[model samples]
Target: MKKSIAVDMDGVIADTETHFLNWYEREYGVRIGVHEIQGREENEMFPDKTVARKFAFTPGFFRSLPVMTGAVEALKTLMKSYDVYIVSAAMEFPQSLPEKLEWLKEHFPFISWRNIIFCGDKSIIGTDYMIDDHIKNLDFFKGTTIMFHAFHNVNHNHHQRANNWDEVLKLLVK
Candidate 1:
């Protein structure tokens, strides 16, 4: 039997930061660079979280995000041995559900719908491994946690880190 691995969509496979940064500049006229995304709190980048939070409500915000480099290829390689599941804490933004599903289908059609999980809490995930960017999720995961490197978590170093797909291959692909 293959070990099952849970993967987060945003930051890991989806380019969410770029979408937010572009919206921030167009919506608020603030030019925030990727260098400024080092904060642990995502909303801290903006003067007020509402500025960013408000944009989350925008339609299609999560639908068309660009895929991260090497993610598709890495997963294709990993799939040969592992049961890959797309697990996302997306219930917080109910509107994003369909969009996320669509985005995943467009980019990762190899993943089956049955393997996709969109829930409110991640503590219920029962898998052999989890690849996520949030410390909150990684801290509670009862498995081998692989922290997918994201701008917000650059300073964090507790869990095993996979800075990019190449690193993820070495860490998970054996």
Candidate 2:
């Protein structure tokens, strides 16, 4: 039996940090350096917290996000031995469902529709392993939790960590 792995979209397979930086600079004309946001959540990084929070609600925001470095190759490698599923909490922003689906189709054509899960909560996922940036999601997971490194989660230290997709391959693709 293949052990299933649940993977997050934003800040995990998607380069959400870079997305924020690019969009923030474009919208506000103030470029916030990566170092300035380290160990801080996205909302806290912007001058106006509401501006950062509104980014996800903006149309085309999810579809235009850049894929994380090495994510596609790493996931393809994992798929040989694991049942990998892209699990995202998309209900908060209802408009993101279609955008996220389109983004996945564009970048991860190999992933089947059955393997994509868009739900309000991740606690229902029963995979043997999960990789996510949010501590809130990983906290309730019964499986082995691997914290994917993100600027927002730099201060977290409770779970097993993978700083990059290379490290993820090292940790799980045996």
Candidate 3:
């Protein structure tokens, strides 16, 4: 039987931070560099918490994000031997599920609808491997956890780290 891999969508596959930074600059005229994002909290990245929260609540923020580079090709390679599932904690954003689905349909048409799971909590997912950018999801995961590097998880050191999809492929596809 093939090993099952559960993948997180946000900071892992979707470059949400870049989306937020770009929007923040265009909308608020504030420039936030990767180095300036020193913490995990979204509000910590900005001088105004309200602005950060406001941006998150915006209608299309989650729906419109660039896919992380190399993620598609890496996933395609992994799918050859792994039962890959796109798992996301999307219930937190009431408006994101549909948009996320649409985004997935556009970028990852090869991923079947049956392989996607959008939920509030991810601890219930049992798989052989999991790649996520958040510690909250990876901590309870019942498998080998691969930490996809993101600004929030820069200091996280408990699991194996993959700085990019090329590193992820080196660690998992072998």
**Top candidate (TM-score):** 2
In candidate 3, what are the lDDT values of residues 32-104, reduced to their tens digit? 8988895557567777778766776778887788999998998999999899999999897778888999999
Candidate 2 per-residue lDDT over residues 111-130, each given as its tens digit: 99999999898999999999
TM-score of candidate 1 versus the correct structure, residues matched by position: 0.95
User: Where does the lowest 10-residue lDDT sum fall in candidate 3?
Assistant: 38-47
lDDT of 2 at 60: 91
- Minimum summed lDDT over a 10-residue window in model 1 is located at 36-45
User: Over the stretch 1-174, how does candidate 1's per-residue lDDT look in tens digits?
Assistant: 999999998889887888888888987788888887685478786778787778787888888688988999989998999999999999999999999999989999999999999999899999999999999999999999999988888888999999898999998866
TM-score of each: 0.95, 0.98, 0.95
- Candidate 3 matches the true fold with a TM-score of 0.95
* Candidate 2, pairs of clashing residues: none
The alpha-carbon lDDT assigned to residue 170 of candidate 3 equals 91
lDDT to native, each model: 0.89, 0.94, 0.89
> Root-mean-square deviation of each candidate, in angstroms?
1.1, 0.7, 1.2
